[model samples]
Target: MNMSDILANKVVVVTGASSGIGRAIAIRAAEHGARAVIVSDVTEAPREGGEPTAAVIEALGVTARFVKADVSKRTDNDALVAAAEDLGGVDVFVANAGITLRTDGADVPEEDYRRLMSVNLDGPLFGAQAAARSMKAKGKAGSIVLMASMGGLVGAGITVAYSTSKGGVVLMAKSLADALGPDGIRVNAVAPGTIDTELLRTAAGIAEASEGFRKRTPLRRLGQPSEIGDAVAYLGSDLSSYVTGHALTVDGGLLAVI
Candidate 1:
C-alpha cells in the first residue's frame, strides 16, 4: 500500500482556483504529484492577496497553467476542458467553484438569484458534463469532484438559495455517478462546513458568528482550506478509485451533532 504518489501523473482541472478552497485544491493536486494542474477561474489574482494559484502550484515543481474561465458559462466549461487536452486530457476534474447568497427564499432578488444559481449550481453541472464527455472521448476513467456544502445536507432560512443550489449539487453527483458509472467515470462531492477563508471572514457578523460556528462544530474550530484541499486530493487520487456517488464531509464534525 505505497500510496505516497496518490495523484501522480494525473492532469487535474480545478475551477474558481483564484483563492479560498479552490486555490488550496489546485495546490494540493500539484503537491500530490499531478502531471498538470489547470487553475481555472474568472481571474488569476488571489482574493486574499497573494500570488496566483498557478504560480503557487508551479513552485511545487509541477506543471501549472492559469485558464481564465467563468464556470457559470457552459462555453467556459467546455473551453476549460478543451485546454486540458493540451496536457493530454484531464484525469481529474474538481468542480470547486461556488458562491453563497444570504437571502431567504421569499426575499431573494430575481437577478441575484439567477446569478447565484448559475454560478453555484449550473457551474458544477456543466463542468461535469464537459469533463465527463472529454474523459469518455479519451477512453479514460476519470474522477469528478463536485464541491457541496454542509448547507446542502441541512436546511437553513438564511441560506435559502445557496442551500437549495448545493442540495442540487449533492443529488447531481449521485445521478452523475450512476449515469457515468457504465463508462468508468467516477463522480463524487465534498461537503465542507465553515472554513477559515477570506470569503467567510468578510461575511456579515464576522467576529461573533465565527465564534458561533466554532462552538457548534465538534472540533471546536473552523475548518481550514487545506483540510478541504486534502480531502479533494484524496477523492481525485487512486486512493479513492472504488469510491463514487458519495459526499465526503470535511466539516470538523459539525454535521454530526446537527
Candidate 2:
C-alpha cells in the first residue's frame, strides 16, 4: 500500500506529458518510486500555463527526463522510447498524446481527419509497437497503457474524427494485448470522461457540455487529472497483474448509467 511499492524501480515513459492528464500521470508515477520517468512531448511548457512538468518532477527529487517528440510520427515515437531505454528498459509505456477538433461528421476536413488519425490513433499504435519490441528484445515483461475517451465508447455529435480515432485506440489496445500476451507484455486502455484539464477546457462548447456532463454524472462533478493518473498507475503496477486487454473506465459513474 505504500507509494514506493506500486512502481518502485520501474522505468516509465509517458507521451504528451507536458500538461493535463499526461503530466499528472508522470508526476504520480515518479511519486510511486519509479526509477526513471521519461516525459515525451512536443514541448516542455505546460498547456495550462504553469511550471514545466519536468521541473516539477525534478523538484520532487525524482529522475525525470523530457524528450521532445511529436507523437504523430512513428519515428518520433521510436526515438522517445529509445530515450527511455538509455536510462533503463521501459517497464511501463503510457501512450497519452492526443488531439481533438470540434467538428461534425459532415463538416470534418480531410486534413483534420488525417491529423486526428495520426496523433490519436497511430501514436499509441506505434508507441506500443516500439515499446513491445524493446521489452521483448531485453527479455523483460512490460505494461502498455493507451489513453482512450468516453467519446470512443458512445457517439458524440460534434467529435466525429476524435471519436473514431479513440474507438480505434480502444480496439487497438485489445488487439495489441492479444499479440503481446505471449511475450508477457500486457496492454490496456483507460477511457476518461470529462476530466477537468486544459484539453477539456479548450474543447469547443466545453462550457455548455460541462454542465451537461456534471448533471449526467452521478458524482456531480468533473473528474480530476490525478484521478486518471491513479488509474494508470494501478494498471501499470502488479496490482493489475491479471488485468489486460481491458478498457478501464474512470468516468465518475457516468458510463454506468448510460
Candidate 3:
C-alpha cells in the first residue's frame, strides 16, 4: 500500500489535539489518508500558536471536525465519539491529552496531584471506554493509542506525579488490549522522551532541553512531536495490525542507557 493509504477510509479521533504532540498525531494521521480527523481538545486555540488542528488537517485534503472535549470527562469523550460517528464510526482513537508539574516528586500539592491525575490518568481511561464502545457498536476493528512518557518506564524524581500517571497508562494499554482483543479492538501506547513541545519547554524551565540533557540521549538530541506522531501513526494503521498491548518508546534511544 502507498504510505498515504495506510489509514485510508479511517476516521481518527485525537484528544489534546489543539497543540503539541496531539496536534502532530492528528496531522500525521490525515497525511496518512484518514477519511476524517476528529480534532478534539479542551479548547480551539493552540498553546504554541498556530492554526487549529482541524484547520491544518483540512488543508491536507482530509475531512476535519473540531470537537471541544475534556478527556477527563466521560460525557465529553462520549460526545467526541458521537461526533466521529457522524462522519463514520471511529477507526482509531488517540488519547493523547495529558499534563505535568514543574515540581519534583515530593513537593507536589494535593490539588495539583488531583488535577494532574484527572487529565493524565482518567482522561485516557474515559477516552478508551468511549472509543471501545463506539468501535464495538459499529462492528469495526479499531485501534486505541494512549500517550505515555519515559518517566513511566523509569522512576523520574523530578516529575513523579506525571510518571505515576503514565505508568498507569502503560498498564492500562496491556489490560485493555487483553479485554478488547477478542472484539478486534487493539490498544497500545507511545512513551515519549522530552519532546520539544511548549509543554516540555515550560516544564523544563527553558526554551529547550539543556545541552547536557541532550547529550545524555543516545541520539544526542531531544525528540520532536512529529516523531511521536509517526510512532502513533504506525499503531493506528494496518502496519501494526498484530501489535497490541505494546508501549512503543520513541525517546531517541534515551531508554537504552537509562
Candidate 4:
C-alpha cells in the first residue's frame, strides 16, 4: 500500500475537528482513504475560519460526518463513538479536543482550572474509554491518539492548569496502553510544541514571546498544525503498529534546548 493510503478503508473519529490540529488530522485521515471520518466538536464552524472539516473531507470525495459533541461529557464521547461505529467500526480515534488558560499559577482562578481540566484532561479519558469499548466489542485491534503538549513535558510559568491537564493526558495514554494492550488496543499521545494555530497566536503574551520561542528551538520556527497531524496519522496507522504508550513530540526542536 502507498504511504498515503496507510489508513485506507479505516473508520476514523476525531474530536475538536472544527479547527486547528484536530481539523488537520481529520482531513489527513480522509486523504488516507478512510472509509468514514467523523468530525466531533462543540461546534461545526472552524475556529481559525474556513469550511467545516466534514465539508472539506466530502469535497475530497471521501465519506465524512459531523457529530456535535462536548468531549468532557462521557455521554457525548460515547455517542460520538457510536456514530463512528454506525458508519463503520472505529479503527482510529484521535482525542484532540483541548483548552487552555493563560493565567499565572499563583493567580489561576478555580473556575478556569476546572474548565481546562474538564476539556483537556477529562475529554481524552472519556474518548479513549468509549473508543476502546467499541474496538473490543468488534473484536478488532485499534489505535487511540491523545493530544498532549510540549507544556506537559516541560513547564510554562503562566499556564499552570493547561500544563497540568496535558501532563495528565501523557500519563493517561501510557496507563491506557498498559491496560488495553492485552486486548490488542494501542494507545499513544502526540505532544505538539508552539504550533502555528490561532489559539497560540491569541494566547496571552505569545506575541511578545514569539521571538524568544523561535530562538530557543533548533528549528528556529513554530510548528504547523499539519505537521502534528502527520505525526498523529503515523501513530494511528500500521506504520507504527508496534508502537504504544509513546508520546511523539511534533515540536520544532524546542524541547531539545529546554
- Give the candidates in order of lDDT, highest first: 2, 1, 4, 3
Tens-place lDDT digits, model 3, residues 157-218: 67778889999999999999999999999999999987888787776533444455578889
Compared with the true structure, all predictions reach lDDT values of 0.90, 0.90, 0.89, 0.89
TM-score (C-alpha, index-matched) for candidate 3: 0.95
- By summed lDDT, the worst window of 10 consecutive residues in model 2 runs over 1-10
Which is better, 2 or 4, measured by lDDT?
2
* Clash count, one per candidate: 0, 0, 0, 0
Give per-residue lDDT, candidate 2, residue 119.
Answer: 95
Judge candidate 1 at residue 199 and give its lDDT. Answer: 88
Off-target runs (Cα >4 Å) in candidate 4 are 1-3, 102-104
lDDT of 3: 0.89
* RMSD list, candidates in order: 2.1, 1.4, 1.8, 1.5
Predicted candidate 1 versus true structure: per-residue lDDT over 154-194, tens digit per residue: 97667778889999999999999999999999999999999
Which digits, one per residue and each the tens of the lDDT, describe model 2 over residues 1-258? 236669888999999999999999999998887888999899999989988888888888888999999888889988988998777789999999998877647589998899889999989999999999999999888999999999889876688888899999999999999999999999999999989997787778665688799899999999999999999999999889989999999999998995
Residue ranges of candidate 3 with Cα displaced over 4 Å: 1-3, 204-210
